[model samples]
Target chain A: AQTVTQSQPEMSVQEAETVTLSCTYDTSESDYYLFWYKQPPSRQMILVIRQEAYKQQNATENRFSVNFQKAAKSFSLKISDSQLGDAAMYFCAYRSGIGGSNFGNEKLTFGTGTRLTIIP
Target chain B: EPEVTQTPSHQVTQMGQEVILRCVPISNHLYFYWYRQILGQKVEFLVSFYNNEISEKSEIFDDQFSVERPDGSNFTLKIRSTKLEDSAMYFCASKGGAGRNQPQHFGDGTRLSIL
Candidate 1:
């Protein structure tokens, strides 16, 4: 069984500042995928970025980047130059590889969440 | 770029009533999926469909729940008898690049409200 944990229940950042949301997971599989999803008040779950366990390189998408420490089982999201639009509930998720059955593929083990608030 | 789309942005129904949430996946996608998000909770995967059949489903997707791709463009989730707990945002997603390893694209989601 896989489990994801988001220690921070809430986070806030001033405009143009940066904020980091923490996440950790428990998985026996050596290969897997880690993802960060954002759910604004609109209620849509949007993918922020993703990182593969085998790849040592951290994933970065514009203002969103991840500090992935595989050995520590830690994958944290960093939002740089944060904007008010970044205010949302962020979740960390894990998925097993396609070739292997995983616990299940489409099923994502998600961290409770870290509600991000952007202050003007 | 293609995107997944779901129908009835919001659905309000009475308990024990049957409700079906629908989605239209990207034209070239192969794997389809359904996930739900209870208010103020994490998004949960319900089932995954591939090759016209269900490849995997979570324990949450019990007998009361069913999924179908009735025709070419539609994938539907039918909850036989809705419960108060079933009220949540239902999301449909699709992934394909000639393989199952592709990153999934999700729909806006249908807000199911049971009162």
Candidate 2:
């Protein structure tokens, strides 16, 4: 079975500063995908960024990026120049690659989530 | 951009009552999924549907829970008899491709509250 862990339960960042949310996972499979999702006060789950285990380079989407260390089994999300809108609960999720039947390779195992607060 | 949409942002019902949560997946999406999160808990996958049939489901999806795609675009999840433990935020998601690389788009989710 695969599992995701978010060590930080709560985090706060000043407006226009940067923040990094930590995540780790345990999986025996070699091929997989990692993702970071954001849930705002409105409770909408939004995709922040994604990283493939095979990719050595980290994934970056505008202000959101991921520091994926496959060997360490860690995938952290970094929000640069954070804004008030970034205040939300962030979750780290893991998915198996294609052709894996453990959970249909479609089901996502999510972390406990880190609640981020943006201070003005 | 196309996205998944769920109806009834919030629902309140008495225990043992039957409730249906609705979702309209993206037009081109072939896969649909339902997930739930209890307050302060991690999101858990409930069921996954493709080609009008359930492809996979979690242990949480017991006999009391069912999913259907009655129409081309509408996907629905029904709870036969809701319990207090069933109160949680239910999220609907859809993905366009068959491969696992594609990201699933999620709706705002319906907060199901059992009284």
Candidate 3:
């Protein structure tokens, strides 16, 4: 079983600044996928970015980037030039990448989530 | 951009009653899933469906819970006998069949309130 952990319960960043949310996971499987999801006041779970365990280079999507350390089992999200819109609950999620009987049916395991607040 | 859409943004049912939450996944998606999140808690996977049958399910998904793709477009999750603890936000997600690693797109979830 894979478990995701987000140690930070709450985080705040000043507008236009940068912020990093930490996440770690314990998985015996070598192949897997990591993702960051954002939930705003609307309560919609939106995918922010994703990283593959095999990729040595981190994944970057505009202002959102990830620091993935496979050896350490750590995957963190960094938001640059943060804006008020970034204020939301962020969750770290994990999914198996192995292909077998459960090929496309792999379920996502999620962390407790970190509340991000952008201060003006 | 194709999106998964869930119906009845909110549902209120009495304990021990049956409740069904519906979702319309992306037209081209081949994988469907149901997940739930209690207020102030992390999202938890319930079940995953593929090829019209359930391929995976979690411990939280007990006998009281069922999933069906009754038609070409609708995917439904039914709780046979709801309990107060079942009250949570139910989310529907779908993924394209092109590859196994494709990200799953999620719907805006239905808030299920069991009284």
**Candidate 1 wrong stretches, greater than 4 Å:** A98-105, B98-101
Report iRMS (Å) of candidate 2: 2.5
User: Runs in model 2 with CA error above 4 Å?
Assistant: A101-105
TM-score (chain A only) of candidate 1: 0.94
lDDT of 3: 0.94
Q: Model 3: runs farther than 4 Å from truth? A: none
**Comparison by TM-score, 1 against 3, better one:** 3
Candidate with the greatest TM-score versus the true structure: 3
Poorest 10 consecutive residues of model 2 chain B by lDDT?
A: B95-104
Q: What is the lDDT of residue B25 in candidate 2?
A: 90
Query: Against the true structure, what is every candidate's RMSD?
Result: 1.8, 1.4, 0.9
Reference contacts reproduced by model 2:
0.62
What do the candidate models score in CA lDDT, each in turn?
Answer: 0.88, 0.92, 0.94
lDDT of 1 by residue, B1-115 (tens): 6889899999999999999999999998878889998987878889988888888889999999999999978999999999999999999988875343457778889999999
TM-score of each: 0.94, 0.97, 0.98
Instruction: Indicate the residue-level lDDT of A99 in model 3.
Output: 49
Weakest lDDT window of 10 consecutive positions for candidate 1 chain A: A97-106
Span of ten consecutive residues with least summed lDDT in model 3 chain B? B95-104
lDDT of 2 by residue, A18-58 (tens): 99999999999998999999999999899989898988999
**Interface RMSD, prediction 1:** 3.4
